[model samples]
Target: MSASNNTADREAKLQRNPHGDFNAVEKSRPEFEEDVEFHYTRTKDIEWVPGSGATSDDWKKHKKIAVDPYAEGRDPLNNYKLLIAGIVPRPIGFVSTESKAGIRNLAPFSYTTFVHHDPPIFCIGFASSVAAAKDTLANIMETGELTINIISEWFVEAANYTATNAPPEISEWDVSGLTPLASEKVKPPHVGESAFSVEAKLVTHHEWISKVTGKANGTLVIVEGVNFHIREDATNESFTTLDPKILKPISRLGGITYGRTTQAFEMLRPSWADEEKREEVKKILEK
Candidate 1:
């Protein structure tokens, strides 16, 4: 069976609410916390030295075991699970693309990251192969353009709904009930709810071949941001930095977990030219 068909078949066997009804499931848990605020706090309250290892004392109490990725009994799914959990707080790329035939797609890809700034390069990892490209990957390859929206806490549920495994004909934008804004360069539109968005063009892509199966496994696409849209209130005069309080970016975690960026602490890079920095490093080295 094809990849899409497999996904459809799997989805078909599932209930709309696998647990109890949506309302019951929601009521069982604490109400969604919406009053969270972004604030700065010190990483550690103690005076530190260069070689001061982890502040926590319990770290050395635990021992780690290693496993071969290709061990006879190990499944590839285990690796996927391990990786997703180990890499905490991944940014979601709420990508929007229009197929050559004009069908629109919107989906959130957690395998997304900004790699460079000189030419403004961003990477999006697609689990499917080029031959079996899904809607977002297919549209990006076909049209060579896409808009990447940053999902904020305000519209995260809407952004996440776009990940539904709907048919190609169905518009995820409509399913998400998100408003779209016309792009300056790309044919695809950007999510208007996004505080920051990037209009990007496909630069190049690479397909990975499985070592065990020797089959096409995945694809990594590189895109160049042609234009950036930042909410005026969320950025400074020069638009160099965005306020985390206003952006309230949502992050992806293991399993069905999502994270918030409501708090942060800043640490300055030490300059060797400063006497205080040199003395600190010198004392650590002497010990």
Candidate 2:
């Protein structure tokens, strides 16, 4: 059977027997018998498939699926779900902020990205629904100070709990039980459990308005990092690059899923500095 048909059959079975855990359904299938070692996939030396036939230039053509986000028949919830699901493994910004009244607020956002490394700028996006003088965005606007903490495997559970939609007076740090480390220049404190943290000041923010509805949907806040606190053990010999094995940072996948940085591989770009590398690339293009 096709993969889609198999999935539908599984759903049908689940509907008929809605008791016990999901394992009950899986138990009906045979166990995997592959000779996999270490319970995870690992990179190995590669050997390209050796074939001597007319190679098709189509290169395994895939059916192009087009989606109109603003289609009249489309549901807003479906658009949100599809976008979040397709954008795999987004980094979470564990943001800490303090209002001018001294109320502390902590939250995690997946829509965070490093705008630039030089002068050290980072951006954290907040949904427009949260713009009304409250929460992280309001606290930052009030104090102009915020600290970003890197969430590692050791305290991800505590970091995850901080994303709760608590009252403006309530501090998520109270429920998370994460120790706050005083930032050097910023008023907000960083998470003591985080191996890496950045004390930053708000530079500016951009409000995003939907073209269709003329409604504001989100605000992207840009901040310049004033100070970076890096744990000695987590850095390399120069203290510039961080060791991924030590950090073990978890990233957001779709829905309630998360991904681990357990397996990785690197490929170097073909440099014009190397004559041999340039010639090899040129030969491939000439084909």
Candidate 3:
């Protein structure tokens, strides 16, 4: 074979089996070159020492500091601040009821949520305070009827005023300076300022144990909606809709924070559509 032809064949063989020479391969690929050594500094020596005269009781000293800041007070404002700050975006239940003596009572509760739709039932958690429970729960227990006025942003302030401590006989409608409108199904006058209200009957009552006092606390009354009152603009031919943007429902948050529904979005899901999308993804992955 020609010298140039032989040289080309040798180069191809060497390229294919470059590790044929172990010493040459070791020289070309240095062991230390596989990993780099970065410059580092050690500032202090870390040594293990047993106990160092520290007692386990030292941890007990921090117990007071670790306690919940809210557990220290009995003030309603403080309790409200903690509840409002922690239980975020709570639905507002503006309840209206009448006493056996024909006195009107209207109040607001953030610890309220819808329970069932078939029977249209909802519940409100009220504390056994002289201010809140006296007129509302006391009256409901007496008359067995109530009207839950769903509050919007416009009337949130008036609803909040109803939470203020007041005399048992004193009506919050008068105290908050809001007019009362007559209801068809119940005697309790609905808040004229509210956008919507539902007359309900006291269907059930549930009692819970208090964590703070370790005693049986007040009851949570389940109310069933009977008649509903919606504003003309909110009611349509097919359904009564209260737009969150227009109604601006106010909600409770953890601490003393209040949330207002300023925006809303909708999502629709069909079983067949979702299944088709899943099958399409599976086919693409298989390919």
lDDT of 1 by residue, 1-287 (tens): 69888556644543334465766877899877878699888877457666668778897799989988899977666677778878989999999999999999999999999999999999999987988898999999988999999999999889888888898999998988999899999999998999999999999999998777789879999999999999999999988999998999999988667898877888788766774567667786677
Q: Which stretches of candidate 2 lie over 4 Å from their true place?
A: 1-62, 129-134, 275-280, 285-287
Each model's TM-score? 0.92, 0.78, 0.65
lDDT score for residue 97 of model 1: 96
Model 2 lDDT, full chain set: 0.76
The CA lDDT at 286 in model 3 is 71
Specify the poorest-scoring 10-residue window by lDDT in model 3: 43-52
Which lDDT values do the candidates have, in the order given?
A: 0.88, 0.76, 0.69
TM-score, candidate 2, is 0.78
Looking at model 2, the pairs that clash are none
Better model by lDDT: candidate 2 vs candidate 3: 2
lDDT of 3 by residue, 113-158 (tens): 8899889998988655322245788788778898887787666777
lDDT of 1 at 37: 92
Using TM-score as the measure, the top candidate is: 1
Q: Which parts of model 3 have CA positions greater than 4 angstroms off?
A: 1-83, 129-133, 270-273, 276-287
lDDT of 1 at 84: 82
Tens digits of lDDT, candidate 2, 1-287? 43334435544543433345757866887864333222234334332222323345465576768999888877555666677678988888899999888989998888887889888999988755334434788887777899998888778889888866567788999999999989989999999988889999999888888656686657788999999888888897776888787777878887666666665766446455574455455676577
| Candidate 3 or 2, higher TM-score | 2
